[model samples]
Target: MPEQTTAAQTARADIPADGAGKPDAVVVRDALGVGIAVGLSGFAFGVTSAGSGLTVWQTCALSLLVFTGASQFALVGALAAGGNPLTAAAGAFFLGVRNAFYGLRLSQLLALPRVLRPFAAHWVIDETTAVSLAQPGRRAARIGFAVTGLSLYLLWNLTTLVGALGAEAIGDTDAWGLDAAGPAVFLALLAPMLKTGVDRAVAGLAVLLGLGLLPFLPAGVPVLLAALAAPAVLYVAGRRRGAGRGGTR
Candidate 1:
């Protein structure tokens, strides 16, 4: 009996704990939560865009064509401030550059077929990346990415229409605290993924860099600079590990 008990205990120890069942459903739930949160921010964007002298159609076109929140905001904000068109576009373009990095990471995570990859590039934003990476496996990641991308695209456009049509009636959305919803929702979705010390460290450094640069740089440009925090942290960490290995031993 004692020998049998010892063998069973050893077997149980070797069997790894399985991930939660119903991973697809879990992915959908998380993706939807984040998608809705981020998408609804389009209300603020619409109001701001219209207030900046863009017609409703023009505002909608920006959302449709640009499909990038920070860039859209930067464009409208710059125009409203009477800044040069070229300068506004430069800032917006830099902000969107981070999406290229996201695409590289997601190309591995998603493994979508060649036919779909081009369309998928439109979905490679911060929110989609966060939700997809939070999933346990490839299937869940793809499902999460698809759900987030599709849901956000639909809701954002719809809300943009609503906000544009009622821009006068909506008054100041800032009064309603809608402006913070995007970041607040994003942090909630991202909190679970910051499980490792490295993740937390990178995030902390990013926050510091972003905030420090915000005062000196244009709105979109600071965010672009802040995106460097990831590669900077990784490079320093790699160098430290190599040093610890004593010149490749």
Candidate 2:
């Protein structure tokens, strides 16, 4: 009896803490689900981009290269509104900056070969980051990341081409309410991440700033100004914490 108990303990000890015990098939399924759902939104982008006066190739190129949905939407949305290209690009650049931070965290989690890092960096967008981080173990994380990235990349580009080509047949894309697809998908992904009070506060403030400034400011400028919401919320939170500590002391 004691021998059996000891062996069981040893087996449990050998298991990975991060839930590496999860089957590869399960991880792949979850990753694919996220990838396919988000990738379909690329149709909206392609249609919107083409309707905004971009050529079919240009719409496809943005999906292929820029890849990040929120940033791409912001750029095209601004341009469609007659904003300056430079300002639109700047807003999109600021939005894409978050992916760099995602890559930093993913670098530690993934630990891919040096040769693969550059290629993998392109896939370190929101959906891939979310799926990878949700996995229980390093191996699972890699699987999730790779599957999500590949599926989303392929589908997004493919759908973008179809949407751009069909844009004329679809008539006014905005009338179909397709323009909201990218942001709706993005918000769905983001809503889960605002798990804390601080996170929620920051998001709320960002929404307020973006909406409040939208009428007065140029198209992309509101987005740029809304980026200040994080620092503003953090500063206030920090001061409150300091004050609470002083009172406690």
Most lDDT-accurate candidate:
2
Per-residue lDDT of model 1, residues 1-249, tens digit only: 445566545544532233345467778898998889789889888887777678999989988878888778767776766666776787778867868988987887676899999999998988898877677666778888999999999899888888788888877755665445445655675688799877998899988987898677655565567668889999989989989899778
**Backbone collision count in every prediction?**
0, 1
lDDT score, candidate 2, position 81: 91
Among all windows of 10 consecutive residues in model 2, the one with the lowest summed lDDT is: 11-20
Q: TM-score of each candidate?
A: 0.70, 0.92
What ranges in model 2 sit over 4 Å off? 1-19
Using TM-score as the measure, the top candidate is: 2
Candidate 1 C-alpha error for residue 18, in Å = 13
How far out, in Å, is residue 244 in model 2?
0.9
